[model samples]
Target: MILLIDSGNSRLKVGWLTATEDAATQTTANGQTAGPLMRREPAAVAFDNLNPHALGDWLGTLPQTPRLALGVNVAGPERAQGIHDALARHGCPVRWITSREQLLYLKNRYTEPTQLGADRLVALLGVRSRLPSAHPPYVLASFGTATTIDTVGPDDSFIGGLILPGPVLMRSSLARGTAHLPLANGQVTEFPTDTHQAIASGIAAAQAGAVLRQWLAACRYYGQAATLFVAGGSWPEVEQEMQRLLKQTGGSPNTHPTAYYLDRPVLDGLALIAAQPDPLSF
Candidate 1:
């Protein structure tokens, strides 16, 4: 078994995969279709700091020790070191992933490819591999601690993307920067009458607006409606607002753009990468 880990700013997501399985025969337990190599459900743990004991306890539940371990870390150098140490204690040698100029059929368009986050690149690769025949100009909107709307051209090149503070981060920033925002805790509405609702609505609108803006740009660039794939922890709230905005703006009736919700895109991407003949060569 190959272990895949996505150590992001807010959580640690881990999964196990077996590349030997035929893609045609495998089914994902989460109701979403399984990728070519994923063999089972992934597990997630939230963390504000690196806790090796907690991670080790979770690792203890694995069916068996993974023969090969691979991961991508956006949690900084200190946390990366901690993860490396924890994996070593569990008898798994880890190969942490980094952004690359080219991998498989995908090409990176970033000015400095390595400066791009591995999570974003891997997520694009996962989506591309999962829907190889999908019409291009694709937009991937990931709503985690920081929201990102990344684009892939018709040629499967990772063009670029937009990033902004996510819902919780936005709320927190407002509370911290201002004297009396009180950290918004209310529902999103079309016309928010109070401060709490207004803050909630504003945050959702900002995220939704970015997604729609990118979708429109992708459509124009590709000369056709582009597909929008949403992922990450904050996707549910962001998607709800996106749908509402699309309806309000009448952007869906004629365009009929496709949208997919991927529950564990990072894990899926890591699994696909691990299945490669030389997983670490990249």
Candidate 2:
């Protein structure tokens, strides 16, 4: 069994994959295809913080102890180190995912490619694995604490990208940095009629608009219309807005970006990396 853990800023997405030769067909309780032949095993987990103790607890719940556990963490070095230490205690081999300088048909151009966020690298890696020959390159956008846009050129080079404040952060900044704005939970359904909705919607619009603008600019700068991918915690709220803004700007709405909610891109990337060895195994 392989344990793929994706530790994000707000939550963690854990996926379990088991390898066995059971010819018997299986199905989820809901009758969804789930079995070895189908390449699926209904996996579950408990919600926990980025704490090692919480992660350890989640690991303990697995049906069988994992022989290999790979993690993709975006919480910085300190948190990643802590999670690594805890996983090691369970005797399950573990590795932290890293950015690729030249792998999966993609070359990283960051001054220090390794310094790029593991989450971003892993996400792009997964994108590249599927798009080995995609024209115009791949554009990855993660909507989290801060929304990020990373461009992998048509030739598979990490051409770098831009970042802007996320919707939540933008709203919080306005509520905190300004006095007139009252702190309100981000729950505006549509454009608000009052000051609260006005502020929240404005923030959402700015974040979504920035993402749309940056993606278009990246397409122009890269000389190819790249495939856009969007992932994050609060993306559902702003995804429509992003699509709307992109279409309004004459960009193809279908190419606005695809949203991945439970995706642990780094973990998926790690799974891919583990399948093949590279310069940096970890």
TM-scores of all candidate predictions against the true structure: 0.87, 0.77
lDDT of 1 by residue, 1-282 (tens): 777778889877777675444433222323454334323333232333336566767677777877777888998998788877777888988888899898678899999999999999988877776665545678888999999999998788888999898888998999999987888888889899999999988999999999999988887888976777888788766666787666565455754444567766777677777777888775
Please identify model 1 stretches exceeding 4 Å from their true place.
Answer: 19-51, 61-63, 248-255
Worst 10 contiguous positions by lDDT, candidate 1 = 37-46
Candidate lDDT values, in order: 0.76, 0.63
Cα lDDT for residue 99, model 1?
90
Backbone clashes in model 2: 0
Task: State in Å the error of residue 101, model 1.
Answer: 0.9
Q: Tens digits of per-residue lDDT for model 2 on 1-282? A: 666777777666665543542232332222354322222222323343447777777677767777776767776677777777777777876665656576565577889978877777777776555443545655667778888877777777787888788777877787789878887654454567788767767776876766666677776887766566666676766765665665565455554443233334454455566555441355
Candidate maximizing lDDT:
1
